[model samples]
Target: MRVVAIVLLGVHLAYAGTHSLKYFYTGVSRGIDFPEFTAVGLVDEGQFMYFDSNTMKAVPKTEWIRQNEGEDYWDREKQKLIGSHQAFKYNIQIAMERFNQSKGVHTVQMMYGCEWDDQTGETNGFRQYGYDGEDFLSLDLREMRWISPVPQGIITVLKWSYNRAELEGRKHYLNTVCIEWLKKYVEYGKSSLKKTVSPQVSLLQKDPSSPVTCHATGFYPSGVTIIWMKNGQEHHEDVDLGELLPNEDGTFQKSSTIRVTPEEWKKNKFSCVVEHQDKTVTEKEIRKNNASDDSSSQRSIFWQWIWHLKLDITVG
Candidate 1:
């Protein structure tokens, strides 16, 4: 009997892009309350995000293992780190081979972009995309259905990876083990704001540097807005916004710089304002003594305060 896979009710537009990618891999592990998985992405091999069941957020693998996991954790779980990294490389190789069977067309880049929805629990899926954003394969775990066509080779690989016995074992794990874990993880992730720290904003200009930069550091939750103002007027042009980088402690930092002549800088009141969780706003002003262009100032501009004002979150 020829049986066709179920067609999803809704129409999905094929994302446009070609994949010049050669490899991608996803590794899943059992956790107490939440499962920890790492996907060695096609875009950046060996560079991927790690989500700990305890943390309930994706962190840099190195930072998570070294700082968060601690020495005791490593000592207790011997070979876990080495095994995980080795498996990561091995999976990318598998992904590379699978990529060849995807379309047989011109494919150079591979993509691995998948996300899980802890809120609904069942709403999780994985997708492989081309460079133009077109999907190669997509799976909807909620329905246990494929959103796109599943090639015969891919199905064969999946079956070979997990036969009837393994499939039943997976069901047992998902039903029994994952239920409690998902609930706790969702709760922890929501209450994470209780441990929030307001950002430390600094306006700095080093020796031999003409640009004054505003640096915001040590804030939880990556959503932050930074702006440069001159004499209380916001200036948009000539502002360079840096990427939100992760700290060793899982907090985030970002910077914005603007070029200003020494004369213009001295004449104008320059300030940088940052907004983070719960409308917490921190603003800092930049000033230098006229004695030398490189001297740093000690005058505090503004004490950090929380404003309930609704403001647009402009993260660039």
Candidate 2:
């Protein structure tokens, strides 16, 4: 039997030379509530963004992962490569090989985000986990930008309208994303646009031992906070938060980094919080222990990376 992947739907923005992307995850659930998993992504231009429910967090690759995972993110993350979000190890290596052969350069971005549906007759949305992975799907955007906080509500519209001059109005780009899926704004045809925004929190952790170095992964177009909390206290020393990486689609990702000590990490509670639009939200807590330590003790196995398809832009 052949497995069909969910298609990412996108629409052209009028007057604006851009597009937005959303992916529907299709997989066999066998009728069971699943676990919660978040997606993380990165780009060739060093852009990063991610969405967990309605919270989108954008930041530089190095710092975000570091903060959330503490010292173990790097090690445990490698183990996760075999699970939901497979690293570009295989695909990126292939792209590099092709570029090596042609002596040319091309750019691509990586993204990881979590999904869920609340069908428990209780909550509002949907989310759950199953198998080694669940209904969540991993995606890649070659040239398209993932515009806006992955739009909210039932009715979402992206239109590129020409700059209409009201006699002498300011030269506006004339773009909007209408979120009509909610109760207050549900409309079949004529509805106003909801100003959508996504923010991110870039977390970084330095070596508890010595010379602290930071490296990480991320998605694009997010608005949030990037701070180091020691024992739940905001520690703002030796930290460098970077600017947001704007997506070709319009949204952006923010980031930052810092180095501390094992003595610093063992203090109490450490966390990175991302508060963005969409009524969406996400967060991560750093434990003195790392996921890699668990994997090592369990003697886990992993799969290699590979790219079976090439992503190209399409238009109607």
Runs in model 1 with CA error above 4 Å? 1-111, 115-193, 280-316
**Could you tell me every candidate's TM-score relative to the true structure?**
0.41, 0.26
- Across 1-316, the per-residue lDDT of candidate 2 in tens digits comes to 0111111111111111112222212221122332122333322122232322222222223332333344354435434433432222233334434335433322222322221121332212211111112111111122111222212210111221121232112111111121112111111111212334444332323335642322121333233455555565776787766443333333334444555666665664555544443343334443232445333211211100001111211000
User: Cα miss at 298, model 2 (Å)?
Assistant: 28
Candidate 2 lDDT score relative to the true structure: 0.28
Error of 2 at 286 (Å): 5.0
What do the candidate models score in CA lDDT, each in turn?
A: 0.41, 0.28
Query: Considering summed lDDT, which 10 consecutive residues are worst modelled in model 1?
Result: 306-315
